[model samples]
Target: MNCLLTGSSGIVGSHIMFEWIYKALVEKTVNHLFVVIRNNKKPAKDRLLAILNDSSRPHFLNDFSMADCLSKITVIPSDLSNIKKQTLEKYNFSTVIHCAGSTSLQHTTDSKEKVQHQNFNVTKQLLTELPHNVKRFLYISTAYSFGIQKDKVTDTIANFKVQEFRNPYEKSKYESEKYVSETCAKKNIISQILRPSIICGRLIDAPFFETPKFDVFYAWAIFLNKYARKASSDFRIWIDQKSGLNIVPVDFVAKAVLHAFLQPNIKELNIVNPTQILHKNYVGDVLRYFKINAFNYVSERPENLNNFEQLYYKTIGVVFEKYISVPDLQFQSETILKFINQLNLSTNLGVHENFMKLIDFSVKKEFKSSYA
Candidate 1:
């Protein structure tokens, strides 16, 4: 089998590439892996070769088999937004995985126009230009595209009219997803979409450990800890103690996406927050696990009556005060759970220890470097 993967250098895309390589080695299903990357300044061929040949970086997440198997991969240069049908036809790909997108949540309305245009244009081009020999098209989308719907969240894609988005990233994703779904349906292309919620590092092993630290919430929490200690404040933030904070690990998301690819009659999958719990309670659990004391000041009215609060809220692209009060901010992941069970897979992908280790590792590194 042959496959083409975009966004091969990104956090999620890199992990997906490793996971697929691992699976290919184990199942002996794929022989050639074609990776398409954007060539802005550096040529795609040289950049990909450098990454594949690098021995210093931990590209396989402690799995040597994946790195070894990566030798069978081929790097291709193509602009996703304007990829030609002839270029894709040369690969004769049996499957195409689309994972490229601007994940910058802080992008303002004005800043997001270019990104949204690229995303939509690229997807449309891919759908129309894909070789007929390709068997499936898989899209990786964000669970946040569901917006702030607090009711029983279903697997169905969110209707833009129902929920209001705060940032361009979310708006663009929601729009792109709709376009992809419609185009796929019209063309009768076998397709699957995976929506993952806030993916954090492995949970609760240590503060300074060997793992990727990519969770914004965890990063913010660590930053808050430093600022709180330095300022001699109680580190209290007002929040609705009853709201739910949905989070999943990156490994789980990758595994779920791969499993969906192998399954039959699986059109759409959500890999995040299958089960929702109270946000304050969830955060409290994480904090308690780390032996951190956090004071929660529950208030009916919004707090932070200063310009700093306004600026901070705008910077994060989230109204922390309003987020705490969202009654139904949970992702439904029943499809992901069923798919995992069907595969008979049991691994430490979603364990809390991994996340904790990453957090500690980042914090200690910051402290030692005097960059905290």
Candidate 2:
């Protein structure tokens, strides 16, 4: 049976296109593949073909040829909301992986009410209008869907006790995931919910140490890169000494997505790093890359600040500070380790090992974009 994939243009989705879909084609597990990429300046096939045809992408994750994989795939150029029923009937899809959604973390009313909530709306719309032949459904939800978990986060959903979310994106995913799980149970569809925590660059899998977007942690890296001047000198940046952020590589995420499909019995999987780079060590490489020596992680908030610190906190820090100052939540991933183990893929380390590589790549890319 064939599979229909959404969000083929995103970083995680594109990685799956390069790695999992290619591997699946070689293994003959999937007879064919269908991709739903929204129309942009170019047709969906042309846009997605450009990404798949990148010869410079790293290997060792999969050894399939691009041309062979291309022949087995069909492009459906439609938005998630716009996919017609006739298209599903014609394709006769057995599995649908819904990975397309807004990742915006904005807390503005318009963003929360419309943009971020669009994830939930689109997901609901798709599930409500699914074809009877679609027996399996996979929803790519964020690990942070735990919202503001009071303590540890298990693979189980009922364990989440968060009343309020840090941002609308987190809240939106939580709502969407809840809807997917509950709806799938009623419809008798095999549902696999994969929650990925802060997807970044690769550590082991193909395109080793590569990332499409330098976002999340890399945004902070870019900030430090910008702060390379004398202006940030002696200006303290506060961090949580005990808590850590769960940032996993894109390849690791792609691996988890593949395994989630393999082990459907193991429904919910947190495709998160086995370990987190505690807030204290999260910025170590970026700080070193920029030769930054002014920041320190403190359990308690600092009352005193220099002029720069004052200005920084009042401005961009208002948003960034929200990320660090939150309750500690340990994401459980041992259940999925059974599947990850089969592939002999390593996800033991978090973002620390290749942090500098990400910093270098992002900084250079940012520089190029800024100048270009």
Candidate 3:
């Protein structure tokens, strides 16, 4: 079998690439692996090698030598946003793993709609315009794609009926799932959708608790870092101590994706942590880590706010209000559990310890990002 994968340089894609190339390629389960990298300044293979060679990367090649993996790999240089049939004609792949999409922070209708268009266009091109050898398609979507369901969110692939969405990302993914499902059905292709919750750092994996990006949970963590540092500011938060935040480490996500694409039994899988991080524990961890004294949780928004508090609401606070305050929605986990059982892996990878590791690493970096 031959496989084609996109987003080879992204957080989840990198993890999947680092450990599985040898097993898939050398073992002959997948005869060859085609990796897609958007080459701007240099060749795509050079760019992929640069990412693999970076010492600060959260993942590594391990016992799998870079040369051995590269031997059976073909680097396709083309952005999914502007896919051309001529670029992909020579390759024959039995599987297409579509992992690249817009995880943009832009919330406006234009921005969100633009993402939807780009995502849909890429999916359409991959299925119809790319080489006809693709017999299986795997889509990487977010668990939050179910929309803001206060009740239990199941792993079912039915359409989400909700009045509101937390953000445009959720909205886009929801639409993308529908499109992928319908298109794959028409094409007589086997499709598996993996909806991973908030993509996080490694826990039990070899390069323990490392991450390439600092967003989502880390975004608000950065907000609190700044909020607590202000001597005159009050550290008040609007949260229910018990509201659950669903997050899964990237390693497990990669593992789940690896397991899903190799077979055709799975239709939809919620790749989420078995146990979620509660607001009380998360707040306590942050407050204790920073030694913030005036810690207070409010059911309602504070009537009058200080300058910083106003700024907080105007910025990241407003962005993440749904997460810290929404009802705890339980993700269906039977499929994920089956995968974990088969792999002899544990979902509970010392939750608190891993959480603190993120806190420590981000704090050491002073919560920096080129995008943030």
Best by lDDT: 3
Candidate 1 Cα lDDT to native: 0.61
Candidates, ranked, lDDT: 3, 2, 1
Better of 1 and 2 by TM-score: 2
Tens-place lDDT per residue, model 3, 198-285, is: 8777764656666667767787678767766662556677886778677777777887887787667888889887778888887767
* Least well predicted 10-residue stretch by lDDT in candidate 2: 363-372
Of 1 and 2, which scores higher on lDDT?
A: 2
Q: What C-alpha lDDT does candidate 2 achieve relative to the native structure?
A: 0.72
The candidate, 2 or 3, that scores higher on TM-score is 3
TM-scores, each model vs. reference: 0.79, 0.90, 0.91
Local distance difference test, candidate 3? 0.73
Badly placed stretches (over 4 Å) of model 1 are 40-42, 49-67, 158-162, 202-215, 222-236, 276-278, 282-295, 300-311, 317-325, 342-355, 365-372
Q: Give me candidate 1's TM-score against the actual structure.
A: 0.79
Write model 1 residue lDDT over 245-317, tens digit each, in one string: 5666555566677777777377767676555546565555555544446444544544553443344344441
Cα deviation in Å at residue 282, candidate 2? 3.5
RMSD (Cα, Å) of candidate 1?
4.8
